[model samples]
Target: MRAKIYGGCVSRDILNFDEAELIKLVSYNARSSLATLGSNNAAKNISKKHYDSLLNIESKFQRRMVESDFNNQILESAGKGDYDLLLIDFLVDRFHLAEIEGKLVTRSVEFLRSGIKPDRVVNTFSDQYLKLWKEGVDNLFNTVNNTVGLEAIRINKVYWTSVATNPQDSMMLNEKWDIEKNNAKLDAMYEYVENILPSSSIIEVDKNLLVADSDHKWGLSPFHFTDDYYRRMVKIFNA
Candidate 1:
């Protein structure tokens, strides 16, 4: 497949680190103030300034990875013409899922689920889950386009229907309504797709379909999902 790149504020290769050592350092420093943590060299006698710098660098790296991954995934999906069904990871405050509308342009629909804040849309998923969704969208877009020549679908917005209080709630909802929400989201998504997809296509999915879910935890900001949730969403989009 052709590779595409995304643009973001963070630099590339920011996450290169010794996972074990980094984890150890973080665990040890969890209680320490930045200044004290800096002086303690449990992982290595790295100065406080250097240690803090490394943490900041790692964070930036992660952010860049998310941006690049998301950009590439969307482009690949577009190229393959899989615009019918799109699954997004968590939506966080820093990463605005709405921004996707610019690229999709009413071609597709989005289904969103969150584990913390239900009032606003957001959720968390593993990086692997995010990758799978990206792949699924890519395949769906490609298959539909190849079978019948037409414009590819574009995802509108992810649906946020239900909320979860904790992991247990999340699991229960996923088991109970995952498929149902998928169908609902698909229905809502089709509305957008119908308006945007070419009129000549023999195979078509509905455009107005979407499913939305949420969690119990309140978001730090009313407009954004938590950082962890946002990261998960980025991974999904990118994957």
Candidate 2:
């Protein structure tokens, strides 16, 4: 049976923005009221074209924020915290914590019936399985994007159906799902911070502000990864 497309897998278009330009626009908006910014007479000192550009930029930025929130929800639900429950919800359509606990009970029973000791099996699985599962899921997501029409939908539907029907196998295939989830979340958070922050905000200032400070003041020095000023900004934001 084909699995219904869970809202989790639906891809929504995200707005792409130039961060530096967005910062400039925000500064401008702060300095002037929206009416003044839109008024031909008030903004006459600034090119009408420039004001119009700001409107376009702001609209796109707003759209991006909505898209970002949607993407975040999807990501968080996919396999982040409580992902097991999310998967179970897709499987059973009942999201109560007790229901999920019950599913776990069922799974444990099946595992024991199959002659696998729950404790032994859990301990024996390695982290490598989770890595492979992550790679597989990413590949499937990318493939869904690359293909089109009924073929893409059918492939995704079957993939999720297989996952739902074989919960124990999926769990076994991704033994360290929790760890992988944390890693993926950290990577996404870092990317979000990197894209939004300003370069100057993250650079370490020496006592004299003349030399780069080498001390690991914030647990990890931002400069360790790349000298790219923007990356330093991301580290500062993360810090």
Candidate 3:
């Protein structure tokens, strides 16, 4: 099945390694929060090409994600009805938003590293953010139901692991991140989304498998889970 993914690497990483190619990634928009989806393009002063040259980022995937956020193209593409499935996770919701050119933008890692500072940064936990996020979620669901149907969607209830599989390896995440706080926010998001979506469409991972992989290809991070975690996800997808 062809799928359009919106969120962080939680679902994308699993499909990326699917040896059987059970699912194909038709479109992907990452490092983008729900708050930015229906808003105006964030980078109005600089052209995308010229802006890319200024950024120190090397990963093409990250660059594309930044572009998606800049253009607010998640719903633009999702409305086209080109894919059979749409998978969404709230990992990017952990990111704070920025106000640029009077538009809310996802203050993603790539965007921060790009050197284009914003007029203001808004915390995701703020009341203003909650209002916008709820509206965005409503818009997203409405768009999907009108075009792709709700049955074509899946929500990955993702959370960061605080433990490491290897005892010797560091269990600490990036100094900037608060594991407990982020997980709590994720809990709220999961609850909010689950309340709107059907339980059958939710992809739930075993908490027992929530351990960081020291030898992960992307290096050690709370979200960089061990092999068994990925294996379980694959089984869920196949089922």
Q: Please provide, for model 3 over 58-159, each residue's C-alpha lDDT reduced to its tens digit, 9 standing for 90 to 100.
A: 787787777677677787787888999898988888788987667787887788777777889989888777767877787788888989898888998778
Q: Indicate the worst ten consecutive residues by lDDT in candidate 2.
A: 26-35
- How many clashing residue pairs appear in each of the predictions shown? 48, 0, 0
Best by lDDT: 3
- Candidate 1 matches the true fold with a TM-score of 0.23
**CA deviation > 4 Å runs, candidate 2:** 1-19, 22-72, 76-127, 130-132, 135-140, 143-213, 221-239
* Residues 1-239 of candidate 1: C-alpha lDDT, one tens digit per residue: 11111111110111122222221111000101111111111112222332232233234544333332323333333344323332222111122222131221100011121111112321212243233334434443454456433342223233333434344545655566544544453453345345645544223222222212243133211112223433333343334
lDDT (C-alpha, whole model) for all candidates:
0.28, 0.23, 0.78
Against the true structure, whose TM-score is highest?
A: 3
How far in Å is the alpha carbon of 110 misplaced in model 2? 32
> What TM-score does each of the candidates earn?
0.23, 0.19, 0.89
RMSD over all Cα atoms, model 2:
23.9
Q: Each model's RMSD to truth, in Å? A: 18.4, 23.9, 2.7
Q: Give stretches of model 1 more than 4 Å off.
A: 1-65, 69-177, 199-239
Instruction: Give the Cα RMSD of candidate 3.
Output: 2.7
